[model samples]
Target chain A: MSCWDTIADYGLRSLGIGERLLPRDNFTLCQQVTLIGSGMIWNVYFGTLAMVSGFFLATAVALGKAAQSPLLRKPSEWFIFVFRGSPLFIQFFFAYFLFLSLKQTHPIFEPFTAAWLGALIVLFLNTAAYSGEIFYGALQSIPKGDLEAADAYGFTGWNKFRRITWPTMLRLAWPAYTNEAIFLFHATALVFFSGFPAWQQRGDALYYASYFADKTFNPFIPYPILAGYFILLTLTVTGLFGLVNRRLNRHLPQQSRSKLRLRPNLLR
Target chain B: MLCYLTTGKHMAIYVSVLVVLVLLAITAVTALIFGFGGAMAARSRFLPLSWFGKGYIAIVRGVPDIAFFLFFVLALDIGFEMLRHGIKCPDWTAPIWQGNDFVVCPEAKLPLGNAPQWVHETYAFFLAVLTFSIVFGAFAANVLYGAMRAVPRAQLETAEAYGMTHRQTFWRVLVPQMWVYALPGLSNLWMVLIKATPLLFLLGIEDIVYWARELGGSKTPRFTDYPHGDWRMWYFLALLVFYLAFTRVSEIALDRIMRRLTHGQATLAGEAQRKAAT
Candidate 1:
């Protein structure tokens, strides 16, 4: 097939579009690049949805964790610990099974079995736990002077939190939050490899890369293409987060503000 | 069968846990060695060495580790076979990469083609360890670099004033103090390493996830012995519990160690300790 013909047939293969069958023999460089690049749509989908939803949930979780009462604090603490402690791969497996069992008993929940719900649920909880820890640390580290200033100005409870505590916590946590965001994006690649089967053979980038590797018995070409896509994704995420970090730290004097540092130590 | 759970699958699960522990230990040591070398190179007067170390850290950090895992496994496998081919069969002249097949002379296989199954398993396990080390080594290098920088400047100056050699001062003052600074980042990295153990399944090692799927899939009487509905979910739930407990225990232990490391240090934790004592 010509390069244009190959593109037309396989460009949307990952979405169960034009191509009925993947290239079997004579896998060309264009085929590998286009197919893997097409598969990247799933990666971006999982990462973006998970990060966006996980952000709000994580904020709530962090607030719960910082609560004064045991009723609120205890549950949040346990939630954070359970999700943070377990591997995301295992979480995917466990969640898949749980969803499967639930569907068996109640068919109405069958929608949860697909990646849209199953993988998203796991990624959501996992990122929340990780970001919760970061936010919790930031909450604790908020300057006593800031709280005192709020109190002196008669900023009470909800108002105090809204006007003072929340902004400060976000500012303090922003750098670490950026690290958590990048890792969450990377962790999304594990979704297909875990319990959630790639429905209709429509898999993610790594999945397609593995498919090509298995067929051609050559890992040299396909895997690097996948890696290149991910590196680009990682750079884009870093750039976007840097912009947010800049906005968060805008009020501070340049010398007093902290720069966002990429730390790869954050994991599921 | 219940008997398989008690004997076969049970043993496999436990063995997989040991596999994870072994991988953890090997990766930690290997990465530390790599990190130390990288750190020294980064601080070297030679610009090329410093650039190489910095570039290594940056490249690994930018890419997802799963990508590296996939790439290295194949690269290393090919590289190994080619080395063996060069040594064991110098006269042989068949192309190793013919279209799709990577056919080396039968004599050139690392775990010889005729070797027992366990040899093949061990080879896969070794590859998994190497992948983990290479990826985690970069993170370790970053942490160690920061820790090395964090060591107080005055101590090094005093050693220089006392006419101590650079190596002597580095060993006596810098190395000792660097640990206190390095401990926090290392502890965080340790947690990450623990969580990453599940990737072993992807590497084709029969870790817990493998057994979970194998033993949990629906079984019919014709398959072997026990027949049951799909119970893979329950098996995975058990795996989750196992990991959660493992990580919780590690967290508690690490917090205690951090406390010990921070005692009498100038950090905020030390101030808190002093206040509590008073």
Candidate 2:
């Protein structure tokens, strides 16, 4: 079959569209790339949803961690500790098994056994914990003068936080937080490897890459193709975050604004 | 619990914990060495070498590390076999890639085709260790490169004024001071390394994750003394707790070490220490 035929068939195969059975033999280069790229849809799905939801939880967690009340602060600290301390791989396994057990107790949780919801929840919590810590650090480092200026302006409580504190905390945290975002996207590769089963044959990019490698016994092609896709994906993540980062620092002078250095913590 | 826990495979599970620890220790030391070499290469005056070092460091940025893990295992295995094939079976060339089969002479097989199980296991473990070291070495190189630059410029200048050669200055003045700067990044990398240990299961090393899945599966009464329903959740929870505790201890230990390392340095921690002492 021609390359277009391959693309038409497996282009959206990961979403359970178009193609039903995966290529069994004579795996061509076009087939490998298309299948792996199709699998990337799941990667994007997991990363985007997790990041969107995790942001709010991370914000709450940061605020909770910074609270003076032990009731709020204690749980936040422990939550950050537990999630940050344990491996994401283990977290996926435990959550999968937990959901499995939970499904037995109630049929409502049946959806939780699937990779989309199950793995998404795991990624959400994992990124929240890590980003919460980053935001907590940023919150603490928000300049004393900024707060003083807010108080002088008669801003208090929610107004103070929204107008002064939250913005400054986010501005300070955005560079590192961008790194966390990239890291989370990279981490979505682990979903299939952990206990969560990919429903039917639909798996992520790495899954299809490995599948191709197994079939062709050529790690050279599929792995590099996967890496190439991820490089594009990473660039896309960094580029989008760069826009938000620019907005976050728009108030500061160009020289004073923080750049999104791909340094700091990444990769679990 | 005791009946199944002490069984042979389960006992191997206990031993696998040691395997994980051994992997950690070896990989850490080896990666640090690779990082040091890489950092030096990056700073070298030669352009190509510098580009190479920089590329090694940057390669980790975009890609998921698990991809690297998967790639290196097969790639390295194939690489070693090809090398062996070149040496041992020069005459036998049926095209190694004969439709998805990497055929090399029997002698080209790592640990040899007739080798014992332990030898094969050792070779596999070695490959896994090397893969971890190479991937993590790049991360360490990034950390160490920054640390090297963070050392005070005046300190290096002073060593020059004292008539020290470049090598001497780097060894005696720069390396010693860079540690304090590198400590935080290195400590973070260490925690990352600890968390990555579970990936050994993917490499087929029979590590703790392997044992957990093996022992946690429901076994009929015919299979063993104890038959239980799926206990994988408990097994995974226990593994999770082990990692959490390990990381917690490492964190506390690293914090203490940081204090000790920064005691006489010029950083903020050192300033705080001096004020407290006064």
Candidate 3:
């Protein structure tokens, strides 16, 4: 088959579309690329959903962590501690088993046993913890003058937080938040690798790359292709986050704008 | 019921904690060595060497490290065998890349197909250490590179004016001073390393995660004296507590060290120390 035919056959294979059985023989460069690219659909899905949902959770968590009341503070602190303290791999195992056992009790939780929901929940909690810490630090380090000015303007509680505190916290936390985001994106690859089973051979990019590597005994190709896709991913994340970063800092002078530096925190 | 906790396989879980600790200690040392080398390479006067260093640091930036953990174990294993095949089975004309298989001569198999089980275990462990070092080394290099730069230029210049050569200056002044700056990053890396120990399972080592699953999985009453429902949640809860406790202890220890490192230095941490002394 021509490369186009190959692409058409395996392009949506990760979503379990177009092709059923994977290319079992004569694995072409095109097939590996397409299959792996298709697999990226899962990675992107997991990363984006986890990140988007996690961001809101992270903001609440950060505020809770910074709250004055022990009722709010204690649970928030422990949540961050428990999640942050353990490896994402262990969390995946624990959650999968938790869901598996829970499924025995109720039919509603059956979906939670699958990678899409289960692993997404794990990644979501994991990123929320890490980002919550970052946001908490940012919240703590928000300039005293800013809060004072808000108070002077008769701003209080939700009004003060919305107009002043939240924006400033985001602006301060943006760089570190950018790092959390990229790492969270990378951490999505672990979803399939962990205890969560990739249903119907539908795995993420690393899953497909390993699939090809195992099939061909040629790691040189598939891994680099996956890395290429990942680098593209990293670049995309930086570029998009940079836009928000720009908007966050648009009120400030040009010289003082914090550039998004990709200092990677490798694993949670 | 308590006896179930001491079953042979359950004993492996206890041993695997030690395994995780050993991997932690060894990987930390090797990763430091790799980091030092990578940092040196990255800051070299030669353009190519510096580029190589920068590239090494940039690698983990883009790729998910689990991908590296998965890729390197297989790649390194096959790579070693292929090298041995070239050396040991020189007369064999068959290609290593047979369709859907890596057909190295049996003679070329690492630890040989017939080697003692310990040899195979040691070999696999060695590959895992190398992979961890390579990936974490890049992270450490990134840390060390910034640390080195953070060492004020004035300090290096003083060493140079004292007739210290570049190597002497680097060894005596630059490396010594960079540690203060590097400590925070290194400590964080240490926590990351601890969290990463469970990934040894992915490298095919029967580490703690392996034992957790084996011991926690529901077992039939026919197989053992103890029978229980799936207790993985409890096993994992125990594991989670182990990690959280470890993290807390490390944080305390690291805080003490950070205080010591910052005691008299001129950095912000040091400035805070000076203020507190007053």
Q: For all candidates listed, what's the TM-score of chain B alone? A: 0.93, 0.97, 0.96
The lDDT of each candidate is 0.86, 0.92, 0.90
Models ranked on lDDT: 2, 3, 1
Q: For candidate 3, lDDT tens digit of each residue in B1-278?
A: 78878888788889889888888889899899999999999999999999999998887777888888888888889888989899998999888887788899999888888899989888888999999988899899999998999999999988989999999999989998999999999999999998888889989898888888888889889988899989988888788889889989999999999999998898888999899899
- The recovered share of true contacts, given per candidate in order, is 0.71, 0.67, 0.75
**Which has the higher lDDT value, candidate number 1 or candidate number 3?**
3
Give the lDDT of residue A197 in candidate 2.
86
Per-residue lDDT tens digits for candidate 1, residues B51-141, read 9989878777655677777778888888899999999999988788888788899999878989999999999999988888888888888
| Candidate with more favorable, higher lDDT: 2 or 3 | 2
Where model 1 places Cα greater than 4 Å from the true spot, the runs are: A151-160, B1-5, B221-227, B263-278
Provide the lowest-lDDT 10-residue window in model 3 chain A.
A259-268
Per-residue error for B159 in candidate 1, Å, reads 2.0
Question: Tens-digit lDDT track for model 3 on A87-185?
Answer: 888899899999999999998999999998999999999999999999999999999999998999999989999999999999999999998988988
Off by over 4 Å in 3: B274-278
Best by DockQ: 3
**TM-scores, each model vs. reference:** 0.93, 0.97, 0.97
User: By DockQ thresholds, what CAPRI class is model 2?
Assistant: medium
Instruction: Give one digit per residue, the lDDT tens place, for model 1 in A1-268.
Output: 6999988998888899988888888789999999998888888898898888888888888889998999999999999988888888888888988899899999987989998788988898889888888999999999999999999999998999988998999999999888888888888788888878899889889889989997877888998888889889988988998898888889999998989887653445
Worst window of 10 by summed lDDT in candidate 1 chain B: B1-10
